[model samples]
Target chain A: MKIAFTAKGTDWDSQMDPRFGRTEYILVYDDEKETFESFDNRDIENEAHGAGPKTSQKLFELGAQVLITGNGPGGNAATVLQKAGVKSFIGAGGMNVKEAYKAYKNNELKEF
Target chain B: MKEIVIISGKGGTGKTSYTASISVLAGKDAIVADCDVDAADMHLLMKPVVEKSENFYSGVVAEIDPDKCTNCGICTEKCRFNAIPVINDQHIISSLNCEGCGYCEKVCPVEAIQMNEMNVGDWYISNTKVDNTMVHARLGIGAENSGKLVAKVKNEAKQLAEETNKHYIIVDGSPGIGCPVVSSLSGANYVVLVTEPSVSGLHDLKRVYELVDKFNLKAGCIINKSDINPEVTNEILDFLKKESIEHIVSLPYNENFTKAMTNGQTIVEYDQGELRDAIVQSWEKVKELVEE
Candidate 1:
């Protein structure tokens, strides 16, 4: 299963972004491939409205089974993701992307 | 020709009703622009007849072609928005989650992804009961770019005013200090700020005043339902005095305002009473100040 993290940087040591929609980058950890991929996500800021929905759409397209981030998605986006059976793990507030992934793997993150 | 915006810092502060009355008082020579695209209601009272309309497109969303015979899920893997979800072993694009960023189109190996334009809203040009044209818009639910829509409404109103040689552009501006409100303030010559005497009303008034002051637009205040609390009314008066804003008029609490709204009429149209006189008096003041 693929997992996603809203990250501040492109590297494994980067801190988790506090915002779901306005994150600098979306970092994906492919547990199956043991690989790290970073997608630049600052373009969402250019949108005048529905940034949350757009970001949620991006994650859905990424095939992210789980989202590990500091902040929760907005109401509409949360509803869409929840309906799609994509689980969220949010206690990665100050943790780096790698640490957030570890927390998910060790069952240390809080489920929304 | 002058452009005066009617605004309120909070909802239900009589902004729309007063703007309707002002439009009537301004008559056929005024071209009106309902800049509150998010929740436009001025057209309701004016009973506008649409003469022209155009669809507003704001963004794009990506779609997937499932017949490519490759359920490799690579498109889903690269999408930044959680737009694609797999169910029943079939992948689909959830438009709500799609940001239209086009990342999926680039990463798809099967050439199955296509970008489609998003229709965000519609804007209208209509002739109102007042014999002048009104520009208004309705934004689609979950649509982005409302500020741009407001700008579009204003631009259309301005062009209409120039084309018809009208003397005023009466704008019913949106109720906050956000992007829509900012767009309304761009070329405004003056502002008729509507407010109440309640504590929350006063709080919002000050915040809105800061924005008006920053833009340096000439402004006047109208205190609706001023009799609800005398102390707060005095506090509002003091605040207005400190800000050097004209106290255009203070209207007493009356059910007639609500009656006009329920009956789909302006207070000036519903009754030829003291309320109508007060509005007429302030409108003359608005003319004086705009000219000054």
Candidate 2:
């Protein structure tokens, strides 16, 4: 399964972004391939409205089955994720991407 | 015909009051368009009797047929606005959250979803006590597309002005620099920027003025309640001078404005004093500037 984290940078040491829709980067970790890929989310910064829905669509299209972030998606995005069957965990603010993944393994993150 | 829009960067800056008084001064020669559809209060002062009215439809919302639905979750997943939800094993569409994008209808596998045009508001052409035509609208609660409604009111007023050979169309615009305000500024010959002497008043004035400047519209400033804060008033004057915004009038704070509102009369009708005289002079200046 692939896991996605909203991050501030493209690396494992980058801090987890506290915002879902306006996150700077979306880092996906592939468990099977043991590889990390980052997608820039700066385009969403200029979105006048429906940023949450657009970000949710990105996650859906990226085929990320699990989402780990500081803040969960808003109502509109939440509906999309729920219907897409993606499990989400939040409350990872202040932690780096690697640390957040470790916390997820330890069940320290809250399910959103 | 010339269209003069009266807008305040912030609410309660006396935009509507000035519009009402000016309408009284203009009498039958000018028509009024109340473009503040969100919280339309011009009718309270104008006391317009509806001469003609029509329902305004804008945008569309999705509706699901329960009988045709195959309990498929595809529509819910495809809806970007989170408008569709499963209730008792049946997917239902919520009208309020729907953006009327019609994506759900397009993506519905069994053709269970249909897009319906939404009735957002109603527009009216009325006869006011001042012996003039007034075009206004009432937006539905929690409705979107107020900007479209404003456009409808302005168009109706413009057509009325042209047919009647009126010289001016006075528009009372919405507060802030949002979509409705932008719609109000479009195609307007002149803008009357009403403001107060408070800190936030000056800040929001600059913000709204930026929008007006972007539209390249000529604007004049009316400093209402100028005596409340002399320091801020001076700051406003300096900024206006720097921007070369014509200073049309400075009106002192008065309780009679409130009293006149409670009595359902314009300040020009209620006051025989300095406030009335200043508004009259300001209206004269506006007529001269808009004509030029």
TM-score of chain B of each: 0.93, 0.97
Worst 10 residues of 2 chain B by lDDT: B144-153
Error of 2 at B143 (Å): 0.6
**Residue B239 shift from truth in candidate 2, angstroms:** 0.8
Whole-model lDDT, model 1:
0.83
**lDDT (0 to 1) per candidate:** 0.83, 0.85
Q: Which candidate number maximizes lDDT?
A: 2
Q: On a 0 to 100 scale, what is the lDDT of residue B213 in model 2?
A: 75
Model 2 agreement with the true structure over B23-84: per-residue lDDT tens digits? 99999999999988777899999999999999888777888889999977998898888899
Q: Which whole-number lDDT from 0 to 100 does residue A14 have in model 1?
A: 89
Chain A: TM-score in each candidate?
0.93, 0.97
